[model samples]
Target: MLKVYNTLSKKLEEFKPLEDNLVKIYVCGPTVYDYTHIGHARTYISFDVIVRYLKYKGYNVKYVVNITDIDDKIIRRARELGISPQELARKFEKEFFEDMEALGLLKADYYPRVTDHIEDIIKVVEKLIEKGYAYVVNGNVYYDVTKFPDYGKLSGQTLDQIKAGARIEPDLNKKHPADFALWKKAKEGEPYWNSPWGPGRPGWHIECTVMSMKYLGEQIDIHGGGTDLIFPHHENEIAQSEAYSGKKPFVKYWLHTGYLMIKGEKMSKSLGNIIPVKDFLSKYEPDVLRLLVLSAHYRSPINFTWEKAEQAKSSLERIKRTIERLRRIMTYEKLHIENLSLDEKEVYERVCELRRKFEEAMDEDFNTPKALAEIFEFISYINRKINENKVPGPLARYVHDVLMELLNVFGLLQKFEITGVSAEVKPFIELLVKIRDKARKRKDWETADYIRDELRKLGVILEDTPKGTIWRLSK
Candidate 1:
């Protein structure tokens, strides 16, 4: 059985979806005020792997991530950029999708934007008001935290404790400091929508609550985001959602990805340490970033550093190299498999065993680091088989296919190149390389160098190896 660590319950629980074999998930998405950073990549990639594994296990999932296209951040950024908030949001929203695609993240089934769901937000605020869970002050609506008795259940804090540590804002109209805004009244030159309270926009936390409910229903299977959202944000979500619907558990499972620290420090705009996702992609492969995100367990804080990325890159290369070796051995109809040698039988069994171990690790709270360790062990076994010249003939293909499936679950081995070349041109390049190889064998240095230099100019990089020459499009 697949198990997940529930942030709400604070324990590992068997993953039983509300409907049989169907999971409904809602993850809080980007604000779209700026380009997504590596911090955002870590969170989205972590969840992408989770969703991939769920599908691999034969579960139908409906994933929704809300796009906060209208917010304080967008407003501020628009003012600085000398554009309207909507214009700024549209620009960054497009950029966010590009970065997400570049990072090889699964597209969410629905990316519901706050701007498009104005009616839904207003309806929820109206319901909360009618249910006595919210109040309006000076055209602004705020959720009455005192009315929601179990306000801190998700975050594991009592109202007194929350009020003690909560940031103080000089809002004399608020009955309690723990109370949070559900709708902010419009100010001069700010965007507004018609509401019962007045012309205003929905609050940040309210947008998620409204969007998740409209898209996935009141009780979802999983609600996920960064750990930093566990407090005020998610806590407020649970409180307001349950209060609105009178549901005991708004979400069946609450999953939060741990924070990504940069060079042992938290990445922040003020710190100027934020690494944009596009910038990182320019320097490293998407799989390298995925591996780095997976090296640490999902719930454990991950320290983002060049060292960690290098280790992940090395691990990823090891898998790719092992697969390449397997590909070479699987072909050529190797003569060793006629009688099923002792080592060959052992290799087949070991590969099968590794698959089981990998599944088990994934079952245990999506333990990717341990799952990857199993993959590394299997790679080691394959290398040993290659060294001993005992590659399984047809079984080698099965081994390769299985490893690729597992690696794909982690979003690795995606072919990303700087430029796109047509399929018709590929064979001609390969033919040229082959003819050049023959020339080299005949000691035709000038001809071989000419071919090499010409291919390099065309942006194809070639490396001559003992097994053969391998080529790829240069980045």
Candidate 2:
């Protein structure tokens, strides 16, 4: 049985979806106010692997991630850039997906934008007001946390503790300091939508609750984000959502990715240690970054340095080299089943055990660090068997499939494959693809088109889709 570390209960619980064999997941996406950084990748890639593992286990997963298109951050950033919030959000939203694509992440089922769901948000805010859980003063609506007796249950804080650390919002008209805004009245020149209480936009917390409800119903199987969101943001979401829907639990499993740190500090712009996702991708392969994130347990802080990235890169190359070795061996060394030696038989049995142990490690709270260790162990053993020429051709093929299957489950080695190109030249092909993408982005059509035509001659086909650009060797 699959298990997860639920932030809600603070326990490792067996995962059981609300509906049989169907998993509904809602991960809080980026704010889109600026370039998506590696910190964002830490959360996105963590959940991507989790969801992929669910699918690998035969569960039909519906994953939804929301884009905070309009918010205080977007507005402030836009003002500084002398552009409209919508324009700034649009630009970064495109760039954000580009970075995600470059990382080869599994696309979310529904990337609902908050700007697109203002009407739905307004309806929920209005209902909260009618239910006596929220109040409006001076055209700003605030959720009265005192009315919800179960407030802060997700963050494991009591009302007293909540008040003790209450955030100071601009609206002092709220009855309690723990109370949070449901809707913020429009500023003089900011974007606004028609609401029951004049013109305003939904607050940060309410948008996730409303969007998740609109897409996946009230009680979802998994609601996840970074651990930083466990407080105020997710805590406020729980309070306001349950208050509006009269639901006991707004989410079934609350999962949060551990913070991504750099130089013993969290990667934040204020600290001048932010590494943009694009910058990281340009420096390393997509799987290298995924390897770094999965090298540690999802709930453990990932302290990144150049040494860590280099370590992940080395490990990834080892994995790919092993897979390539198996592939190369498959074309020869045709030993019959009956002709197999005792050691060859043991290798086959070891391969089977590798799958079982991988599943076991993944089952226990999605323990990726252990799961990865299992993969590496298998790789090391199989490589030894290959060196001895003891692996049968069919066994070699089986090992290749098993390695690809397991690595793909971790969202690694899923992008470019070695078909027409040799293993040594694959990195060069990937580099060309990246360069062409950049050229296209810069509107250097002459260079972009030149690369595309040259690559076409070299049997590389670039397929552009809504998710992002992907390349393949033409069969």
Candidate 3:
């Protein structure tokens, strides 16, 4: 059975979906105000791997990640750029999807934008007001913290404790200092939608509650995001959602991934220390970045450093080289399964054990690092078997299949396959490489350089070794 660390229960719990065989998950997505950074990549890729493993384990999953197209950050940035807020949001939203696809993140089943769900937001707010859990102060509506006795249950803080840490809002009309806004009164020269209270827009926390509930239902199997959202963001979501639906539990499982830090400090825009995902992708292969993120436990902070990234790249290279060697052996070797050598039998048994161990690690709270260690061990064993010539053709093929199945579970190695290249093109690419090499031998510098540069533009990267020139697909 699979187990997950639920932030709400503060313990690892056996995973059981509220609905049989169908798992519904909602994760908070980007605000779409600017280019997405590495922190965004870390969180989304973590959840992507989780969903992949869940599907691999034979459970149907419906993943929803909402787009916060309407927010203070978007408005502020749009004004500074002299563009309409909608225009700016659309631009960044497009870029966000590009980055996600480039990183091989699984496409979210639903991407509910806040602007498109205004009616749902209004309906939830109306219910809260009718139920006496929310009030209209002037033109704004705020959820009364006192009305919900379990207000701080999610964050594990009392009302008094929350009041102490709360940032004092200028709206003294609130019933209590800890109460949060459900709808904010529209300011001058800002976008507004007509609501029961007046011309206004939904608050940050309320948009998620409405979108998640509207798309996935009232209580989802899992709700996840960065741990920084646990406090007021998620806490306020609990209060408003439970208050509206009168459901005791807003979500069945609350999974929070740890933060991404740089130089022992949390990565944030305010700190002016952010690395864009595009920059990382341009430098390192996408799977290398995925490995770097999955190297750490999902609930543990990942420190970003070039040294660690280089190590991850090397690890990926080892896997690639191993697979290449195994392919060559499978293509050339003859197999006698009935009379296997003792060494080949031992290596095959050990290879089968690695799959069991990989599943065990994944079952225990989705331990990706431990699971990856098993994969590395399998790679090492296969390499030794190949060197000793103890691997039969059938056994080598089985090992390759198992390795690929496990690697694809993490969404690695498969995405880098060169597309649009045909079987007939291989000999031509080799011919071009040979022609380029001959040009270099004859000292035809211009032709050789032009061919190399043109081939790069066609997504082929050429590497020169003392043995020969090797070519591979570029990211």
Against the reference, the lDDT scores of all candidates come to 0.87, 0.87, 0.88
Sorting all predicted structures by lDDT, with the top scorer first, yields: 3, 2, 1
lDDT of 3 by residue, 1-475 (tens): 8999988889999999999999999999999999999888889999999999999999999999999998899999999999999999999999999999988888989999999999989999999999999999889999999999988877788988877774546457888888889999999999999998899899999999999899888888999999999988999998888888888688999999998999998889889999999888889988888999999988999989999999999999878867765664574355565577888888778878988999999998889999999999888877766766777787888788788889988888875444556778878888999999999899999999998999999987776655566676653
Per-prediction backbone clash count: 0, 0, 0
* Per-model TM-score versus the true fold: 0.88, 0.87, 0.88
> Root-mean-square deviation of each candidate, in angstroms?
4.3, 10.9, 5.7
Higher-lDDT candidate of 2 and 3: 3
| lDDT (C-alpha) at residue 120 in model 3 | 86
Clash count in backbone of candidate 2? 0
Task: List candidate 2 stretches off by more than 4 Å.
Answer: 331-339, 419-475
Model 3 error, position 444 (Å) = 30
In the range 1-475, model 2's lDDT, one tens digit per residue, is 8888889888988888899998999999989988989988999999999999999999999999999999989999999999999999999999999999888888999999998999999989889989999999999999998898888788888877766764654446978887888899889999999888999888899999999999999888899999999988988888878888888678899999988998789998778899998888889988889999999999999999989999999998788767766775674455466766799889888988999999999999989999999999988888777767777688798778888999999988886456667778978977988898899889999998999889999887776645445566553
